[model samples]
Target: MADFGEILESIGDFGLFQKLLLFALCFPNLILPFQLSSLVFNHADTNHHCNADWILQVGPNLTKEEQLNLTLPRLPDGSFDPCKMYVPMDWDLSAIREYGLNETTTCTDGWVHNDTIYDATIVTDFDLVCENTNIFRAAQTIFFAGVLVGAVLFGPFSESFGRKRATQIPMVLMLIFTVVTGLSPNFYVYLASQFIVGVALGGFRINSIILATEWIGVAQRSYAACLSQVLAALGQVMFLAVVYFVRDWRIDQFIMAGPLGFIVVYIWFIPESARWLLYRGKTTDAKELIQKAAAINKRTVPDSLLDKALEEKPVEKGGIKMLFASRVLRKYFLTITFAWCAVNLAYYSLSLNVGKFGLNIFLNQLIFGLSEIPVHFFCMWSLEAAGRKLSLMGALIVGGVLCLLTLAVPQSNYVAIATLATCGRFLMNGAGSICYVYFQELFPTAIRQTATGLGSTASRAASMLSPVVNMLEIYHFTIPTVVIGSLALASGIMAFLLPETRRTELPDSTEEAEGKRGPKLSNPATRDCEDIQATKL
Candidate 1:
């Protein structure tokens, strides 16, 4: 029986066709997140705040003149005078206005505001300050909270079903909620819809990362993973374009919702992971998928090789318990969880605060997105040569240092701060992609998805707190940057403790990974001291 790696070797390595397939599948995942961000950021409530609307509630007994006197400016200078603003003392008018109210002219003399009429309407109900700070924060918190739930569920579903199926289901759900979100009649409904949208986003995000890595050869896995995120960055850039054109949040949500229809096209072209199929005891299906992949690469598959690839070895059914049962596995799990949390904390905190950095919001997002192109290439190069741990450590350290530097600068030094922050973003982005690929590589195949899902959930959980942390105003910009920097530094130190995995074959089982027996197919050379210790039990 030929080795599975050798069989893959028989096919072309990272050829044009393989790259094209990955590129097509990666494109949608990348674009979808940014489009979703539009829904998050451009809602009517969000825009009203951005536009500085100070909505105030006033009694209906107040004439239009009186209402205007209370809300609108009285001075010729067109500035509001808070001292002169007054509202009617009538409780009935206040109650009606609070529920829904309309006005009509009185026949007796001057116009009289009527409180009896009821009309349901969507109106900005908060002052500009409340809208900008509290409302926006609420939206961000809810969105990520949904993401946390979806990410937790993403792995189990993907493992139970298949990668392609798991990946597409979220897109369908995202399409449904995104369209409905735009049509939401009230703030509560809109918020609820965004939460659902976040869940769909969580599923799509995890599957996209997993599937992208699964489809490629080991030699190309690192590069493929980095490229997938590069596309994500591109999605961020594309969002700027979308936001520029469709300024309204509801319209933007609809626009984002519309492209999801294209994801249905993936059902025809995207193939399930051959590796996942092989692991799931669907060897024949795996072989068939591999053959189609070979065909796409213009290669032939031998029947003998295909049959050999189908033969099963003893493997255990993995569950969440297996992740923490062993010392080595426990260590990897903890390291991955911390690293994921740190990455997300810094990544999201930075991304969510880009508008505060003095660059135009659209241009800031564009710059941040464009910076990722080089970061992805740099990550691919570093991971392929220097290995995973070092790449991650470098990224974390660089990002942390830059984040700390932000504290020393003033708003007047906007360009300098932007440059530093942008560099930090690049490093964090690259580090995150590196971590995703590295964490998956470290786990045994049986529990890979579970571990990945757990790590993703941890990251999302940490992300849920980002908005709250970012909302802190006491220390100005220093507080958030300091917190993000400290977390990154901690993650970098923890990363150093993880084992190096460059050129090392992925472990097939926990026993093999622990070196319980002789060297396995994946690692056939002299055993290290740690391997011997792991095998001793």
Candidate 2:
């Protein structure tokens, strides 16, 4: 019986069909940054001060300077205290400038936001300042909480219902929730919308991989995986460009959501995974898609090929249980999950906390987005040359070390600090790209999505903790970076323990995953590693 790999070899592997497939699959990734990093724009706190109605009473007739002098208390820096104002007492409008009120209180009426920075934001609109700061973190946490839930749900969903539907359902929901978020009239509604958006995004994250990687050949799989990640960087640039002009948070949401809606129509062009169809005993369906693919790629397939490809091989029921049942599988599961958690935590730590760098945040964000582009090319070269395990470890170790070194760069030299941070961001982008391909390659096809989804759950769990870590600036400045950098370092060391999957045929069954894979195991030596360590027992 011919394996899927054999069938791919018979026809063109990197043919026109696969190239088109790669492009179609990248759209979701391009939109992902909006849901992932929109918090940067949405949660921004514009300059503000206490809004005392009595001050306005004096301000209707007085200049702005006189009203601020009478109503707001200046901090040590001579800037008005946003959270506090002079208590309204015995203020004569006739001599407002002369009237002095010493007693100060929290802003009881509301805040006067500086519209120049943002028309309105989640922070400014909802008053997430002062004692309510924790609520802001809670809101960000709730979004990742939804992603954690999705990590559990989408795995089995992709396995059972098929990858195309799995991809479509979440995409449609993402569009709907994003649109609703923009239209949200109140804070609670926005929170709910964000949670739902995250849920849908989680669904997209898992299914997009299944759709993209399942169709490509092993040799060029790294290219497909890395190129898809480049879209994530592209999405960040798009977010900046859109928000640069559309400063209103609601309008920004609207602009981002619009493309997602249009994409729903275009996704119809993307075909379901033929490999998944074969896994489910839908051989006829798989053959039909393969025929269509051959036609699209302008390749010829023998008439008997379908019959040989349909030859049955026993497939195990792979899930969370199957992963832990064997010692080898258990080790693989634990190591990858922890690696995912550490890498994601470190990656998002810098990605989310752009404000803490003490630089012009917009420029910092632009640089961070730009930094990831080179990483895609780096992954393309390194994953092929050094193979998966070596490249992955290199990225994790380097990214972690660079992030830790960021602490040594004095904050006074904002440019130096920002440069080191961008380099850290660059390395993690490579680490993360390799991890995405590694997750799919590591596990059995039967349970691959489930295991990948579970890993995603771990990563999202780490991401959920990030807001709290980022919030730790109130207690200590270095703590968040320390925690994430430590995680990256630890995970990088653990990367050595797992089996290398580069150039190895993806495991099709739990038994295959459990079986011994000495360096000489796989038949294809074209792209397999030279050293025994790449496929060591």
Candidate 3:
């Protein structure tokens, strides 16, 4: 039985065919950032105060400033209290001013929103303020919850049905749901629509990585993975381009959905994973696709090589049960999943808190997108040079230290705090990029998608909790930093437990995953460390 990597090498691994396919697969990443980071804009905080228009009937001639002064209470800073109002009484304007009102209570009428920063947002439209402030976080959490659900469902779907269906169906669903989200009349409707959009996002994201990785050879898999992430970071920058101009959340949704319409059509032209076809015993289909790829690359696979490939019949074992049946795989699953969870937890901790940096929201967001681009580019080299384990571990541990150092900086020095936070974001994001390639290479093709999906599930679960954890800052300024930094440190320590997959082909069976076979096929030099580790285990 010929290895898939050998076949990929023979058919021109990173040639014209693979490049075109990778381009098609990576294009959607540009749009995904809109949905992923939309919360920052969609629920942007604005200046607001309790409505006190009830006094307007008696004080018809009163100026807007005088009306607010008479109808609202003041805090120590001399600003009108945002959530409180003075009790209204039937009196003339001059008489009301003469006799001061002492009683204060929560706003009986709805709040008035300032539209200076954002023309409209879910926060303004729904009055998600004061008592309802937590609702915005809840909605964002629900969206990530949907991402978790989609990952759970699509993992088996991709492994059983095929990667093409997993990718295309979600593209269509994301398009439909994004439009639905934009047209949502009520906050509840918006939440439901965003949840479905998240579901579609989860399905599309994991399978895209798997399908692209499966088609590329071991040597260039780093390029395939890192470049896709670089594109995703560029997508984040593109998100700023769209949102910076269109401030309304509804219009933003509509604009972001526009690109997916063309991508859905173009995606159909790309072929399915030939490696997946062979693993499923669809040799005829795999053979035809491989031959076509060869023709496109201006190369040829010998008939004898093709004959031997068809003769390779894999024993099919898959699903969640198969994932945990082996002890070594279970260890890999737990370690990688924690790495996924920790990276996401720390990543979103900084990303979602873009406002605290004391910079323009659009500029801060641009800084975030720009910073990630180079981190991924660096990952492209370090993943191949220092190897996966050290790269991820070093990134997380160093990033964690930066996050903790923010606690020592004075709150008045926004510049210093911002600098530490930005550095942490850079390292965490780099670790995240490495995980996409590292996780795919760690598992066999039989349950590879399932493993990836499960890792995504764990990451989404962590992301879902990130907003809640960030909310802890209300209790103590240092609470969120302590928690996120601690998790990053622990997760970096856990990375040492995972085997280094550098210069190793993706395994195709449990036997190969367990080191019973195929390790020698890629590089005996690299496999020695893995085999020795396996023996000790």
Candidate 4:
């Protein structure tokens, strides 16, 4: 009888079957983070009780004399009339009093007294404003920033430690911080917890993606990665139901954080990446993991295959410096970095702002999340059949153009503009999903994780600016939309300059990558001349 390792080696050496299995294993990890985005968006609302009656009643009820008193605070020139302070409809005095609204002073004082409770409730209602939006955006930025750090460090760490141990560390952290986030008593504590969670979340994201890719064959890598995100989108929808039922942000946080506890159980079910094991010179462990994988797949492996796979081990341990060693590698880095930045800017800006559009915030988010299913399939089909560059360019151009057209739709045409904006969102979401998979394929195994992390960091840098851009856009929608559109268009054009990777085997080295298309790879350079030229145009 063949041992488990021998069976796994016969499964076509990490092809479609392994990719599919990895997709299944990695699905939950992907969804958990994306769904958390919605949780943050939901909680970011500051104006949840805006329609609460007591809040409205706190304003001056304007008896003839009181109305005159209200007018007294105005400028003598009548330019700043205090009487113009209008109460919005739907504010409930009863709800305010029940929640401890002080009726003696205007409702404002009382509202501020119970601000935390009210804020928490309103966050559920999805009325987040500037401060809240900033907090939410900041949390996401820090999270991605953590991802950047993790991606860079994880490659080396995973190389030294076993891949299984490296992957589990983040999962453990995610569980711990997630629980801490729920128990946070104050905003500062909550923010800190989120930042910590970001670190864990970041690690989990990179490890899961890289591990899944490594275990699969090149032919199936793109589909596997894309499928992971697709399941993540499904998780987004599932979380909608979770948020709807849970209602409280803290409770929702706990719900999201809790699932990670079970992931540890995967230790028994999931095997370490054979590639990482091989690279680390642990032929015995690598062979063991491969055998286990074959057993899971119900296949038999031959002993001869395992003997043949035990190849050369390096004399010197390779570090991240290896990523920077060639001109072509540098080019790949720059292209992916800029591309990720543009994709993230457009992708996140739209996701963060979706609540502002005139639709039921929860329902709209659910719809938006669900839209990714079909859109992802479209992306997969287009990417496989059409060139990656062409598909990406088309999506970017369409999304950018649609965003620009949103400016033409009058504010009075809120419904029409919102519909158009959603279309733009759909395009960007699909494009972004494709870009993640595409970027992975563009780089070789040596620097794949490093390249991804750098690209992700660029994207995070862009994301850090998104809140500022969003705030600016609030003053005038047209200006920000135009800026986003311009960036998207530029990204599409930049993509045109990069080489296509479809049907080509992944480049073994930076020098090989450059030599395949345009340039000769020399010593590792910090920046690629070609990428600089593309950006300059």
Candidate 5:
């Protein structure tokens, strides 16, 4: 029987229709960075100090600057400390300058904040500064915790309910919650919204990638995986530009939500995955989508293609049980789970920590997004050349080493640290992109989304821990680097333990998946050659 790949070949795999699908799917990918790191700009730090300075007693009329100068200790950066103030006592206005008021204490009065750059952020609005900072960081932790739950939910949802519901529900909810987050009047409301948005985005993020991927043939899988991320990078660039114009976090949220929310309208156009439909015993629905694919791509559907796809009866229902059923699969499952966790931990840690390198945050974010573009492009090509295992392993090891090298660079040199950090980002981006394609390849069609969702859960767990790792800088600066670097190094070594999947067909059954050794020759699918050649035009 000709499997789905041959059937896809008969119906013009990756032709005009697929390109159109890619453009439509790119919306979620584009808006992802806005939700993912909206706080980076939305909670931007502002200059602040204790209110009712001791100098106010010196004279009824003193400039805000003079009050701050006389009352606050200077930070290492030449800025006045926001958390501490001089003791208020009787003093002569004329002799105040001569008085040695070296005594100081933590701010007893409310703070006076200065916002020269950002008009408002959660930090300014709610005063998420000083001791309240951890609660603010907890917003992200709460968000990732929501994502962790989402990853567990979406994969199984997509498998049981079909991809369209799994995807579109999250798409709409993510948009709604993002706007609500902006409008939230207090920290708790804002954190609740952040958590829901994270939940919605987690489902949309993993399931959408799998939905489109399952439709394409083996030959296009490598580039298809990164295409999703390239669209995300494009969104991040646009997000940086948007932040420059919209300084208020609340207004920024509305801007990101309004236009991209239109994606919800396009949901009607998104076809159900025919493969997933067939796996769930909906052969009639599968054939209908197949026919639509043929008409849109301007090709004839092979007769009885759905019948061929159904020849190897799939397990009636797909779930996490399949992931642990076989020793080989269980090992692959554990190894890739760790790899995904390490990749996300390293990626989020560096991204959130970019402000510490003393570069402009917007510029650093723009450059970081730009720097990782080449890695995706490289993955687009290298997935075929280096193959999945070598490429994934190389990215983890090299990215890990580059990050560790940061410890050797002097703190005074922001440029060197930023450069090495960007390079590490590049490698991790490669690993992450490769793993998206590679993990899906490791499973059969019936259980693929389930396994992917489970993997997403583990990665979210890592992301939840990442902020705490980033926070370790206060205790010891090197601790974060050591933790992230060691995970990456260990994950890279684990990559060697998995079988290589180069030009191999997506497994049709769990038994078939377990039967094969990992490495396969990097050969073009000759079955797909004529169709792919036609696609070149």
Candidate 6:
């Protein structure tokens, strides 16, 4: 039987139809970074001190500086304590000044935030500072938890339904929840809406790649994967621009949600995945879509070729269990999934806590976003040149080493810390970009979405922990860096065990995916012709 790849070649491996589909699927990728990284902006740190307005009754004539000096305690650093204030007394302002306040307590009133950088953030609006800081981190954790849930649920949902449906539904849900998130009356409402948005984000992120890659040829899979990220990186840059100008989390949320409305409308035009259709035993629908694609690409698929594709039997539906049945698959599954977790743990830890670098948050985020475009582009080449395993391993180990190197730098030297972090982010992103192609190629089509979803679930689980790990910096500055770097190093070592799938056809069945069979070759004639052409050149 002609496998789906053979049919893709006959009709158009990367012809107009495939290009159109790839373009459409990748467009939505631009908006995802807004949700993923928005926390950095939405909960940005603001200069604040405890509100001590009650003292104003007695100190009505006191200047602003005088009020703070008299009402708030100073830390050993000589800065006014942000979380504490002097207990109020019945004495007059003159007597209070002479005696001085003896005891301190937590902020009795609200926080007074200096919103010069951000006019408003979830932090300032909800007063998620000092004792309430963990609540902001918890909001991030909740969002990633939603992503984890979405991965488990949407993976199978896409497998059962068509990929187009999976993609479309999430776009709508993302839009709705994002709007709700902007209008949230309280912190609890914001958390709930963000969680739903996270769920939708998880579904769209997974299925978009699967739907695009299922139509693309094996040769272009790296390009298909990395290009989506390139656009996402650009989106990060653009979102930074939006955040820079808007400066309010609510308006930012509404602006981010605006693009999705158009995406939801246009996505309906894209067809369902032919590979998915065939996998579901809807061969007729698969054949029809293929024919339409072939026509659109200005090519004609042979009747025999189409008939052979139809003759291939549908895969059994056993969900994730199918991945564990084979010993070889189990090893691949474990190795790749752990690698996914480690990379995300490192990536998001730095990504979420950009403020810790002590640089201008906008400039810091801009540099971070700008860096990914080149790194991902380089990754596209490295995947083809150095091969998947070597590329992933090199990026991870090197990135981890850079991450560890930060321990020697003083936190007060924000410039030095930001420099090392930028370098670390550059390499970590490369490792992450490689995983997208690596994961898709490792599993058979029968369980590809399931495996991808589960891998993403592991990554999201890491992302959930990433915020908590960042919180550990409160105990000791070195803790977050140590944990992140250690995991990257460990996972880099784990990458040594993964089989190289460079220049190989994607496996289509359990038999093909097992043992050494996972790295199945392309058509002998085509490969030979390419080799011969290379020799002649």
lDDT of each: 0.71, 0.81, 0.87, 0.62, 0.81, 0.88
What's each prediction's TM-score? Answer: 0.81, 0.94, 0.95, 0.77, 0.91, 0.95
Candidate 1 vs candidate 5, TM-score winner: 5
Q: What lDDT tens digits, residue by residue, belong to model 2 across residues 358-475?
A: 7877888899888898889889988878888998888888889888888897778888888888898898878888888888888888888888898998899998888888878678
| C-alpha lDDT (0 to 100) for residue 290 of candidate 6 | 97
User: How does candidate 3 fare on TM-score?
Assistant: 0.95
- Candidate 5, which segments miss by more than 4 Å at Cα? 53-58, 73-79, 86-105, 310-318, 517-537
Which regions of candidate 1 fall more than 4 Å away from where they truly are? 1-3, 43-85, 88-133, 474-477, 512-537
TM-score of 1: 0.81
Clashing pairs in 6: none
Q: Residue 485 of candidate 2: its Cα lDDT?
A: 81
Question: Model 3 over residues 271-326: C-alpha lDDT tens digits?
Answer: 89998898888999999999999999999998888888998684667567888988
Over all chains combined, what TM-score does candidate 5 have? 0.91
Alpha-carbon runs more than 4 Å astray in model 2: 94-99, 515-537
Q: How do the residues 343-398 of candidate 4 rate in per-residue lDDT, one tens digit apiece? A: 66776677777777777677677877787778777877887788677888898888
User: Which of the predicted structures, 3 or 4, would earn the higher TM-score when compared with the native?
Assistant: 3
